[model samples]
Target: MQDEVDAVQRILSALADVGLDSITFVAEMSSTGRSVLHLLTFGPAVEAGIGPYPGSLILVEGAVPEPWRRRPHPVPRAAPAASVDAALLERTLRERIPDATGATEAEIAAAEAWLGVALPDELKALYRVTRGRWQDWGDDYAAAERVAQAVGCELFPLDELYVASALSRPCPWRFAATEAVVSPPDAAVQGLVGSPGWIVFGDNGGGDRIAVDLTPGPRGHVGQIIMLDHEQNIGASLLADSLTNLVVHQRGDRQSSYRVDQPTAVARVNIQSMTSIQAAAHPGLEVLSIGVWDGEPLSLAPVTGLPRLRTLTAYPGTLADPLEIAKLSGLEYLELGPEEWRVLLDAGAVPRTLSAAGIEVHGNRHPLPIVALANELLALWDRPPISQTILEGHVEV
Candidate 1:
């Protein structure tokens, strides 16, 4: 679900207050030299490990009134509970990661030795996980957006984890993390049938990154997607070029294996995990979905690699190739995440095809409207034009 304008603004302001400044805005308005209230701070908040803080990470919404104002956004909230004991959790993690130890110094030393870099003073204050060989480091580890300037290390995106806390969602960390503990999804559990969309679970399935046997609910199925929670390796997963209906994985566990049971022609994968799904180019591939789990600054490559790729998930950050892909012969589906949707709507990129072969996104609510619009548009394209006026109305939050 999306965040309320006020909540986002307050969060952004807090980021700014914390001494972050270098920023990037990926909204449609940002491209047109316009502005949306949301902002993303980048670079080191400080320089030379000394004086004058560079800038703050501020994603503020402009002071718009009414509909444009920051409204309460919906999200999947978790049950409220006690905070995890940092010391105990630390020990548990140490046991799981092997290198992580109960002592902070040992863990810090291990991170430094493995990652081949010195830990920033501030970074040491929080938990640190090295990007393992098979790990993607997207969902599992919430990196700080703005790293310490002196270290010259890239800032990690930890906003998603923080947002989970603000919304009172389940601590994604508590999910089966260690390989020994994380078992494969049972066939009986295969497919989330009750869910509106297809869901794929990733586990300790070795080189087979995705375990697709989850049970589905009675509700209508939109399509299949995979969730690779940082266990599989990107290059290895792509090597199979299986193109399962959906893909999902987390970050920091790239070594995990992923497999594609269906042929590329049969399935269109939507990957929300930090890893990119477009491995080999296939003209038949319909959609390439991506999302920013927290606030990690990741890029989505255009179908430049995939000749058949038509629909692309709209996430924040600049596109490697927009015009080129816009000209794709049969390109159609283009949906945005909660963060990118507002920008897409404002940018007026909603093509007639958007009415059909539409994009799906994550929010507190369902996206039946987008699907309906796409169906209507496709119907109109085949026959005579139908009045789409009814859909022109704004969706009530």
Candidate 2:
């Protein structure tokens, strides 16, 4: 097999030889230490080189031939020492964030008026650092979360993981950074300070399942309130409100992987995103409501041993297997969406412990069955669950 650098050269030579403009190759290491290649090319030029070039078929190649074309996972490095200017950052927020002036003041009184909480020292530092412009990796949610991490704030693990993954849909929020760990059963989800800034939990395979979401509350308190969206389209969100903390994903660049710390509070747990998993391995879990969306697997793989899960709401299209649902035990609510609902209906099975206040499926209007499926979902709700559902009366084609 060719070495990592050699593999990169081979791919680049083929692309450059054919005059393929705006094409670049991203290489990373899979957890198994195999090389993974993500070919990012667009427009019509790439069509010509298909036959004589790489071993894989066109569109975009995820993993390369022989060597697999992966790169090493980036290790944490120290951030360049920079000075913090609270006054400057506060001024920047005042100019940028609508009503941000109200969020920061010389004292807690002024700060509370804006952000609804006394500014913690760590939070203050973070806000000061990223008050105005900071580097973003394309996703709006990821950009906002990056701003939150600049200080010492942290996201609750269960919510953190789910929201990061919910962006699996073709939206700006899907830019996620992940790190996998296999610890003892007794291991808890520690390293809040150092864990990958975000975690996503949903299905990626081809079924509908419950959607998981996280809604940020006052002072980041995590007020326990869950909202369900069974449309199998809307991905959930759990964001870190500081720009100081950072996480890196396979798709990101060197600058995107750095660690930044900020301050945050455990606000009300808004079930903006909920999965079928009933419990988390870590303590301090605050659950709100359950919803459904087409994203990643909400259930745990038997090999992963994720148990003690309580609530789940997801679409079936996010996971590799359907039987992973057995891992969750305490699911009180469910919203199966369209794809998962069909599968569940076909299987003639539902979770034995399932008890939902209501059920909704998203019907689709597009030519694809999922479009009718999304539209069907709207009928189940007394009101639209999402504020922004159909953009210009045209759902994504």
Candidate 3:
């Protein structure tokens, strides 16, 4: 018995350095008096390569006291509190934006009835603080909206709460038919359709939408927010785990809700003014489509490190030389603007290994001039005259 107690004491002392907080032990003794002890320790320092749930268990040969087999006493706790504090959120919003106004209970109730779904408690708390609108707080706090707009959605609007509520019958605005030009395959389309309970609340002023997914796809969870890009052929990319997370994020909390398991063809979307840090974080990108609304010259230097980049769509002023982009051996598709195409053709620097190559020309002008030139230049290479419409009447080849 002395030996058994000494062994346990020594074991506890050894584990003290590892932050061991609690220990439970069990023992079994044979008729010959030999015994075995099983000790389970909680709050131990997790070892390298350990999984999310970490703990330690030790087995020692000894006769332990019967008291060791009993369960440990329960820990005490304080009274429960709301996960989100409505008054605190309101205070924060008022501090940041003096014009912020919270939604009234009647407004929230009406909106919920129109949508035919109850808002999650956290989201309800958020609305009670602020209806849905908040000014761009700054770079860090506004990163979500910036990333959403870059991918395809317009400014994240809180007015969506009221507008979506008004258009509740049949929910025409609930789903946007993806343009056939950038649509995913039938299976992927079916997967998206399976989760038809998406409520679009805002747009990019173009046509793309930002929505809260009530019925998530196979790889997503309900209540998660996603961006639906109708123009770029990209389907849904998760933006936040929940509306509550989005609100928390805007308060300068750095957490990622970006989910990347979409169909490969429409999986990647480009962000304007991308930095090397952002590119390294999204190494799974399959397509890099640059959009520069500022008309300032863009650079492809930041994305050269992407190991999985398969498609390169270079807008005007994005590249100084075609070879600078052709150097990426993994790139399978290349789309270039007129001037870049001319430079590449002139220098014979266009990589012949590309699966598809085309020139992109923007505007509503007669395609005869550009089409004739495209055929002349691309006919020898056996490529198609791929033209995309930037606007209702403006075509980009």
lDDT of 1 by residue, 122-234 (tens): 23433443222223434333322111111122322222111101112111110101001111232111221111111122323232323211121121111111233333211
Alpha-carbon lDDT of model 3: 0.45
Backbone N/Cα/C clashes per model:
62, 110, 4
For candidate 2, what is the lDDT? Answer: 0.30
Error of 1 at 190 (Å): 23
State the weakest 10-residue window (summed lDDT) of model 1: 173-182
Per TM-score, the best of the predicted structures is 3
- Model 1: how far residue 375 lies from native, Å: 14
378: Cα error in model 3, Å: 3.4
lDDT of 3 by residue, 39-140 (tens): 433211211112211111111122111111212121122111233444454454455444335577787787778766776554465555445444433334
Steric clash pairs (candidate 3) = 154-204, 359-397, 360-397, 361-397
lDDT tens readout by residue for model 2, 58-160: 1112211111111212323312113223354444444443321121335334433443333334334433334322222234665555333422122222211
How far off is residue 110 in model 1, in Å?
77
